[model samples]
Target: MRTATVSIGVSNRHVHLSPKHLEMLFGKDYSLAEVKDLGQPGQFAAQETVSLVGPKGIVEGVRVLGPIRKSTQVEISRTDSFRLGIKAPVKESGDLAGTPGCMLVGPAGTVSLSEGVIIAVRHIHMSPKEAKQLGYKDCDRVSVLVEGERELCFHSVIVRVHPDFRLEMHIDTDEANASMLATGDQVKILGRTQDALDLVG
Candidate 1:
């Protein structure tokens, strides 16, 4: 079996704003203040925050991730979904069609979205060179083996390869807690889904 080690990035509930939405939420000509750079290139945690208001309740102080995207998106955990009474589907970034939307409250104003909320699917971000070295390609499903007291294999993890990406496996807070994983913790990619199917066949 082919195996490769990769670092983990545990993601918390956050929001990505589009240029238009950012202006609506923060005010015209406003820009995001970068507090910290993320594992992925050109991505950062902005100092600003916004409140997400749903049918049942409101989740406040949700950090905004930067730089701005073409469209705004909200990535929350399953627990967060229940608290907000939103049935957000597990989807890849930018795959927001037919998903739920909510009201975003900011200091300057508020924006009501038609659809843009999702529970981001766990995925690995790797550069093309790294992907080639790992024998994987973009959008490939693979299994990852975690080691520790709660050691287990994570299945159906999608691979995202790009020139600007750095090698890192991103999981939500819930998944990280279940496996007791932290940022920079190393995990092994066992093989692609086809490899497992071939073995079974």
Candidate 2:
């Protein structure tokens, strides 16, 4: 099966902080310094990194992404979750309800979170125009076919459409390794949800 092709971007473990958490971890009046622009519009990787302390272990040098959000969230891979001994559910960004939490240690200070860690679900970010062209809508489920040395099909990929979004599929490190996919690689959209069948057909 073949359909539209989307560029792939491998996402590493990272944290997004709210202003208050940023202040508590970095320092009062501290602001994130952009290291580089990301594929998604307006989102960038900060020069700063922090250590995540979980019940079982600590993972260091986790990049911080900017700009700051309304709430702090940690996105890790399932392998990292096992290493840290946290059962982080696979969730979409900003869906932190009932998620796990961990302590974040920065240069100036350390902050403990009550809850907000997750194994980010695989998703595609695209603009409305691109979504319409591909016969996809926001929150629609789809599958993707990755071809090459490590061929595989990724299911339950969420479609996220926004005016500011660029057309790209985001997968965590583990998924990337399993499929031997890296940033700038392309994946073919195989199928979408049943309701959108006719549209893709």
How well is each residue in 1-201 modelled by candidate 2, as lDDT tens digits?
228889999999999999998998889999999989999989999999999999999999999999999999999999999889899999999999999899999998999998999999999998998888878889989988899998988878999999999899999999999999999998898877553455556
Off by over 4 Å in 2: 193-201
Highest lDDT: give the candidate number. 1
Cand. 2 TM to true fold: 0.94
- How do all models score by TM-score? 0.97, 0.94
CA lDDT of 32 in candidate 1? 97
List runs of model 1 lying over 4 Å from the truth: 197-201
lDDT value, candidate 2, whole model: 0.91
Worst 10 residues of 2 by lDDT: 192-201
Q: What is the C-alpha local distance difference test score of each model?
A: 0.94, 0.91
